[model samples]
Target: MSATVSREGNASVAGVNGPVLGDADFRFLREFVLQHCGIALSEQKRQLVQGRLLRRLRALNMKDFGSYCDLLRRDPDGEMGDLASAISTNVTSFFRESHHYDLLEKTLIPQWLAHKRRQGDRLRIWSAGCSTGEEPYALAMVLAEALEKHGAPFDAKILATDLSPQALQGAREGVYSLDKMDGISAERRRRWFLRGEGSYEGLACIHPRLRELVTIQPLNLLHDWPMAGLFDAIFCRNVVIYFDKPTKERLFSRYAKQLEPEGYLFLGHSESMHGLSDDFDLVGRTVYRKRAS
Candidate 1:
């Protein structure tokens, strides 16, 4: 719920003034985040919900959590998109959970290359919940070089999406602070990042060519996915952790449908194929392949 907490006491994203969650407040948080962003907060994790949403209350100028929830309900347009953006967890970077990328580069890409070697074409992967675009941009830069080495008669494109317009804007701009790329390889760093210059110096941006390979767009994962054709791979890592199990099952099933036969699915490291479906077969840590049926 949106609360106009007193802009009092210490202030931070995690800190806010609000009535602690009681039965009604817990229900409100669960319903609100779910309706807006498809996140299902659990009873055990009620405090986590309170902490994360408190910041939003402050931003919306709601005097308390009740008023915040009221605003979400009253806004027919469902300003929940903004709230959804805030609520959705997006802690990812270029080549996160390195082993996944390692497999993509070492094993999967080679397999795709072998199958497609006879035909000159383009490779397409969708990075759902692409956040600030680093993941796709890094993929583009790295994969391009890999393709060149393989002499595959093809290029690659990464479709990056997020539910947040703010995140999408950051992705489209392809800009980053230094910390965003610490995990990137030095060679990759040199090739993909352009050093900031002058007053804007110290910041870095994805090289324009790499930026061009990724098409950034705003997308609500809980809503219709606008593109067509199955992807060669889908990198929706770390995104489903906030969604409840039912939502994860449904979302992953949708992901299975959009993937090409044998296309890859990557999830957060802590996430598992457990209780999801037999539709995907786990091939590596958090890496999955669509089952043949």
Candidate 2:
């Protein structure tokens, strides 16, 4: 699976101090990213990609982009996460898009819980591209509160997944600095997070209850999914902005298949499904409901 890329074009340019991403390597990387992650890197993003991936190169102790491309060609799965992480922004916060959570908390969870009251019934939510845990923990807090409020014996769980190994580790740790707590309300802060004491001051740790509700794992959305059942709702906010149109269409189609009938799909504020998907109908701001088959 090794790709043959010419290394003779390597040189410093455009203030890229380290191994400049030569044209050949850049082309290979662009295709590699699009093929594996569904992120279309345009020519305009060349310098940015070069800048961001320099850190990856430094971390891997690699001298040039050609070798890096070779590594990816040889072992794509092993290095894909780091490569994706290097190129993509994982900036996220608790309740990053409050409106989506509002819809979930106020309407969806309650309705789903009511309907799934039987002994074997279950409620499931998937946080696709759940970077650094905030999204899923926020989801957990909402689900936890709803279950407590409903006072019902029911099974509920959230699946939080991402391609970045580093981000998944952070999500698993469930710890964050005080600054990252802005989007979380004071009441939720008091209820769902524990303040780190003494030497660990200024840090917030997620409540054990939230940890119990959320299961964090490594997943690449473009790859084969192992999930067997349909989800009541899925939060894929801010993750698809990097994808091209065809990628978005394919991803949305897969999402439709993964959702329960008339299930919800939440997207980032800046994203839209207009003309990209027919499986969903826009029901709210960046909120879509799976069409009945």
- Give the clash total for candidate 2: 0
Error of 2 at 137 (Å): 0.4
Q: Look at candidate 2 and tell me the lDDT of residue 127.
A: 97
Task: Point out where model 1 deviates above 4 Å.
Answer: 1-26, 43-47, 76-78, 117-121, 150-155
Best by lDDT: 2
RMSD of each: 5.1, 3.5
Candidate 1 residue lDDT tens string, 86-119: 6566666777788877887888777777777656
Clashes of each: 9, 0
Model 1 weakest lDDT span, ten residues long: 6-15
Give the top-scoring candidate (TM-score): 2
